[model samples]
Target: MKTTIAYLATATALVALATAAQAQDKKTLAIVVKGLDNPFFEQINLGCQKWMSENADSEYQCLYTGPASSADEAGEVQIVDDLLTSGVAAIAISPSNAPAMANRVREIAPDVPVMTIDADFLEADRDLRTTYLGTDNYLMGVKMAEEAAKLKPEGGTVCLQLGNVAADNINARAQGFRDTAGGAEGIERLAGEGGWTEIEGCPVFTNDQADLANQQMADTFIANPDLDAFILVGGWAQFAPQAYSQVTDQVMDKLNSKELIIIAGDTLPPQTQAFRDGRSHAQVGQRPFEMGYKAPDVMIQLIEGQTVEDPLYTGLDVCNQDDPGFCKDN
Candidate 1:
């Protein structure tokens, strides 16, 4: 009986040593968000780090990456290439340009799960990426249009300031906006009616530059002071302080009088607080936190040869000053 007990303890020790060895050989998972400056992407970073902390026992190493420029498709592609060469266990990315990124993901998807966040691959190459986890951007746009109509009940002229013209989300959002706010799409029409007119130099591309977006807004406002509402598809300039430099002091004051309606999509701490500070009428938020958090889990599951939800979706959380959840603990 003594010999049997000793043998059982020895086997258990061997198993424990093997487990430790495997634990040390963790697979590296890479998460690439949109831009370093964007707060929305920062939330994704939080999610990734949070997932790593909660699953401290797992054999996974998380790497979070962000680019300096939001419009740099080549830069995003290079990130994917670098991760692939470094032999990452899996990869999750927010593509700047879906059409540009489609081929790059094709090279790596067969070997690892190339989960996409925020935006997705083009229609033809949608199969390249393993799965997509993001908000229904079209519906988000519709929501924005709905809000715009509510504010300008008399019907007013509105212009949309767009960022990264190549981004899939931006395009879908524009179409959705047109469907409800700008033009007739034969839909149920939840928002603006014929009372709303779209400006010609409208949908001015900002390229996601802080100064440039501010300049565009300031210039457009100078040209069309009567511009009643603006649907900021992405809050590019609002992220930094320079965003205030270009707009004239008089124009900036209009936000308080409710003369101009500015509704933005994708809320982070800064943007939400900006809303709270009365920068805009309302903010429709995308769950980048969930995107960042779930991305790692999905990638790890793929690495472990397990099944995950195909095309996982994070949702939009909208709020105003009146809502209890309005930027709570932001």
Candidate 2:
């Protein structure tokens, strides 16, 4: 009887080991983000790639693809379709829209689970999504408003440069910032006309010739030098120095007292450098890399028929020059 009991225990241990090994042998996952031109996405991709390589026991792979800019929804769609055809076990995406792509993702990868990161699709069918991993957009907006209010407690004309207003993520943030500061005394929201464009998308040679769109931004600032603050809905402030360099030498004195507090939604390497160099006031940062790192793991768990959470609300923090010593913490 004792020998039988020992034999049963040993068999159970062996089975458990074998199951663990099988779990590690899962196939690769497809992680499609918006664009790599932005360091935020690149950093996230790097984290995902690093985690996959380091965990050699896992047979997972990451299929990374996106356009040079986030505006290329067709390009993103093509990549997702291709990955679906290529037999990836699952896919993670920062989708362009909720209705348009959600249906297509369902049509293409019918059996596979789709996880939305950073940007969630509003019309996405519950069955198509295993989880939504990203920040609570409305809350972040409120946070931005609070920060912006602190800069101009009395409320002045605050201009908002909404980046990709079509994208729900940016829109939510813009609205959040608005709601946060809407009630403040003398606070006025001056909506600016602009969207997300590549930094290199518009480069200046001698800071004299105005790139059309940037010129418009400069004009707005010049017109409203008294504007209490300029809120960049995305990390659009990173492009400001280059834009301002166009007229700084001419109007340094004018800008000295203007006190246009610049606030942004996310932190990229350039934006981080901007804050360090005194170009921006504050940046909301997230552990963007971890999104890439965990994207595949979450997908793998779903593919293996293991239960995964329906949504994972990640966090983002604010960073300024004061916290330069802890850039990593941000």
TM-scores of the candidates in the order shown: 0.83, 0.75
Q: Against the true structure, whose lDDT is highest? A: 1
Model 1, 121-211: lDDT tens digits are: 6668777777788888888888888778777766688888887767888877777877877557753322446577777688788877777
Backbone collisions counted per model: 0, 1
lDDT of each: 0.73, 0.61
RMSD in Å for candidate 1, one decimal?
11.5
lDDT of 2 by residue, 218-284 (tens): 6666676565566666654354457645533444454344466666667766666666655556777
- When superposed on Cα atoms, how far off is each prediction in RMSD? 11.5, 13.3
Candidate 2 Cα lDDT to native: 0.61
Model 2 C-alpha RMSD to native: 13.3
